[model samples]
Target: MDNDEPLESKTTEETETQPAPQSSDEMLYCEAEVPTPVDKEKAGRENSETDLEIEDTEKLFTTGQKELYTEACKLMGVVPVSCFLRNMEESYMNLNHHGLGPHGTKAIAIALVSNTTVISLEVADNCIMEEGTLSLVEMLQENYYLQELNISDNALGLEGAKIISEFLQRNSSSLFNLQLSGNNFKDDSAELLCQALSANYRIKEIDLSHNQFSDKGGELLGHMLALNVGLLSLDLSWNHLCSQAAMALSNGLKANITLKTLDLSMNGFGNEGAAALAEVLRLNSCLASLDISSNDISTEGVSKISKGLEFNESLKVLKLFLNPISIDGATLLILSIKKNPKSKMENLDISNVMVSEQFVKTLDGVYAVHPQLDVVYKSIQGLSVKKTILQWTNPMKLIQSYADQKEITILDFFKSLSATGAMKMSAGEFWKAMTKQNQVPLNRSQLRELTKRLEDSTGMVDFSVLSVAKP
Candidate 1:
């Protein structure tokens, strides 16, 4: 054959070797072909191996956790062995020591209650170190359920505190109460914590007692307090906070309206700090309780507080215990009480303070002078007389006559009338009428007869009988 004829023949052979283009239906049928039995078996075997591997890994993790827990329980000697397998909402095992080293404990803590809502773990008096605290903080950051955490007395120093502060800053945790008391957190740690608090609004209460927080830490905390509206209580007792810290706290208190209770006891808040706090108290309308006990507060400091008390009506409890407060301070406090007639104060503790007998006597006198004062005195016959004399300055002969009778104290008479049913009157109405009448005191015999008649008449006894002579 010629060369051109040979090439044409080769092209023809190539074309013949190429398969023809199939129709759309033929393509669809080819694509829909099912896998062979061997391929199906191979796929199923691979899937089964994957499932087994996953199950084995899970079993290994679980077994490791259980072993750790058992070891921890044995180390801590916690009785009634409580083991949680899954779904721990709020785990409160305060003071329970699991003998795991810091790392192991933290791992278990994170694993055991990884999905908890609130973790109140009190490792007080434990020897937890920085490494353990860091691990715990990492777990906290990863956790979504934990809200309130109490890790007090873990011996975690500034380094550990810093780690926790980092987590607090990043996590939008539901944690509201964070107690770091007895942790020896110094100024740096405190500042870190305050920074975290300022950034995070979830925490409501922070206890920093028994730490080394000095003026710097106090200043930071105070600044945070000024801006934070969520915090309700702040305890900085025994922190060596001096006048500088007190001044900062005072400034913060002026801006803060949500904080109701503040504890500054054992902080050495001398006259300066006390005066600063007093000023804050004068302006604050929400703070209900203040504890300045065990400080070096003297008469001057107390005078400042007393001055504040004159303008403050919200403070119901004031503690000035273990201070150098004397008669002068007491006198000032009594005067403040007198000036502020609308004070709703329930208790005032100045115990262990250098208060003079004269101060007590003055307090008694002031107590006697209050318009709503109720003085309870015991008689020689062991009978208690509660006399709530009104502030009526007018001299009425009828009241004098009743006072001379000395039959019963005003409270006793009212109580008897109430018990006898003669005073079908409600407590408010009876007090109103009694108050309106100026409480004409009656002699024991007359009071007794009145009560008896009141009982006999079921609170409907006629008062006209008192005008008649004795039978």
Candidate 2:
């Protein structure tokens, strides 16, 4: 009987007396004994209650919704989403990029009036013009179930803004989130919307990016932010807010207490604007996140912001990516955060900017004090000191030319290079892609510079912006 020797087989009688072998599934429920009569009765009652609850949930979609769905399907020449008809208990309906034009949008709007199950709805990039928006506004006025709505890129210009403004003015508490980006809303429409927002107090978040809002509109909206007490998040990126406008906005934010997140990226907010925002940061304690990437903020502006960061305790996330703030500016930020012993700062995004070794060492020391703080960047001190054959040139033109030569849309080109099938790619990935192709004829230094020039606060290059720039 050596340890490695095989055991003998059991006798037939002994095998018969042994317990039966159990499968994995049986082993899992080995302790689950047969229920007693009383236990069975309790389980039956619980199952009956669950059945009744399910039935009630199914009834949330009423006969009215069925009739509306039928009518809408016929008018739109397409079946309504299963969430409306079949899965009547669903709370979200996403119809983004469905090519639902004005007619289809109106038909859907008519059906949505009776939809009590849906709480969040998305109909973005559907080509729903002003006519469709009018129908939606009418539906929104009547329908009270929807709490979140997205109708971005619907070509709903000034008229649509006015319609939405009227809705907001009247709406007491139903809607909580809104997305109105790329709607061509100008200063006048912005003023009207701001006035409406000022009066209404239910909306918690809003996106007004890619619009035509200038200094005047920015001022009005800033005034609205000062008065509005319910808003928690506001995005005004890719607009025309300059020094004066930004200063006005910052001044207004001094009095606000509820707003937590603010994005003003891709604006003309230079050093002057940064100086004003510095004042805001020093005083405002409610703001948790602020993004001002690509606002032409230089070392001087960073100095101002650094001074603010020394005193700021509530701000958690700061994105200064794509600014001309060199290593010196990054160092200032690190020192500023370190100086603030009570700093609640969590994320500091200086992506696409090259940092010096000294700056990196200082950031490491700051990490000792604030273990939760994250500093995001792509390039190091070596890249900053490299000499280039040619002076810095705009790579956007080359990218556009490459798209043309490839005989594909700009979006398609970017999507082809993107690993996630999105319109954006990381700076490192983009540079690698550029190196593999002669379509974008540029040297290594140029490629590195291109990545830095295009990347946003998250170190992502959004190539789809080129498509929007096209006619």
Candidate 3:
């Protein structure tokens, strides 16, 4: 045998000493380890090549071409045909790189086509002056398709914010989202934004977080929520919003129905602010998630929120991260969740709050209960004999089938029912009456005719009962 290799005799002896293959049952007990494929080195090389290609393409855009594009954008509407650059058709035309001073945006605005569907434009990190911002606002008023415009991290003061807000009020542009984060927008700017939101309903999400929006801004936003129903999410986190602002917002929540998600995290909302929000939660029925994490909310605030949860059924997620909630507050929350059947909260983020092991155990116990309940006893109970039968059914389904034959909603069907005084009583009472009177109900043809007449009339049915029955 070679010096580097094991001796052939030794190898043969080792093979002989090894155990033989076991029976099928014993073999089944053995676990197999699969080897992982090794292609990481090859992937690294491929990524390096792709990065090189991207760098090479970026180098192809000459400084002169960029300047030409910038000049073309600046002269957009000023010279009519000057805005129709061949390169602008490809992507966003950046004019700030041409060293055109603070008025660079104005140049681009003057060149842009009115009624144009420019999807995105970035003028951020540049010192665009107030006059330049106003010119851009005018451009926004005429243009329709600009969905996103990032002017954050710039020196856009309250004046700039107001200008943009005013343009936003009139522009029926298909802009659904706006980000003005990191701008120094104070209370006045916030008020302008609120007014803009009230007039314009297309924007669904607004990021006013990280601004200098104090109590005044918070109050304005609260009032705006009462009128603006299209907005689904609002981010006002990291603002200097205090208790007064929080209270105003809470009051607005009482009337607002469409808002689903609100982020007020990192705001300095203490116990009083939290208490105000808790009161709003108790009354509101549409909000599903609220993030008040990283605030100065103390145990007293948490206690208020726990009390509110006893009545709140719509809220699903409540974030209280980094709050000062102690064991007592945690215990109260656990007890509330256990006692309240209406509390449908799925997520309770209490991370960093001081809670005891026993409180955690109590919360776990609450989770252990069955989701549904069964009543074993009632004040009155009845039994039937001799094959006597009764059935409880949804009368709406029967009416729906009749309406479906003619293609109409239950509202239309009820309208026709009113002319014949068929719907004089409440829908529940009418349904009960129908069940008691009809041993064998009307034929399909007769039902269809009844639904058709209901659809023909301008009568109305009271749906207050049905509305109240909804969870």
Per-candidate TM vs. native? 0.60, 0.67, 0.56
Assess the local accuracy of residue 4 in candidate 1 as a C-alpha lDDT between 0 and 100: 10
Query: Candidate 3, which segments miss by more than 4 Å at Cα?
Result: 1-101, 106-123, 369-471
lDDT at position 378, candidate 3: 11
Q: After best superposition, candidate 1 residue 287: deviation in angstroms?
A: 1.3
Predicted candidate 3 versus true structure: per-residue lDDT over 91-197, tens digit per residue: 45433222223344554554443324457776655566676576565656555666766666566778887777877787566667676777788888888888988
Local distance difference test, each candidate: 0.59, 0.74, 0.60
Point to the candidate with the largest lDDT. Answer: 2
- Candidate order, lDDT descending: 2, 3, 1
Q: Count the clashes in each prediction.
A: 6, 0, 7
TM-score of 1: 0.60
Q: Highest TM-score: which candidate? A: 2
Better of 2 and 3 by TM-score: 2
Which pairs clash inside model 3? 74-107, 74-108, 75-111, 76-111, 77-110, 77-111, 416-454
Candidate 2 TM-score over all chains jointly: 0.67
Tens digits of lDDT, candidate 1, 182-211:
887888888888888777767777888898
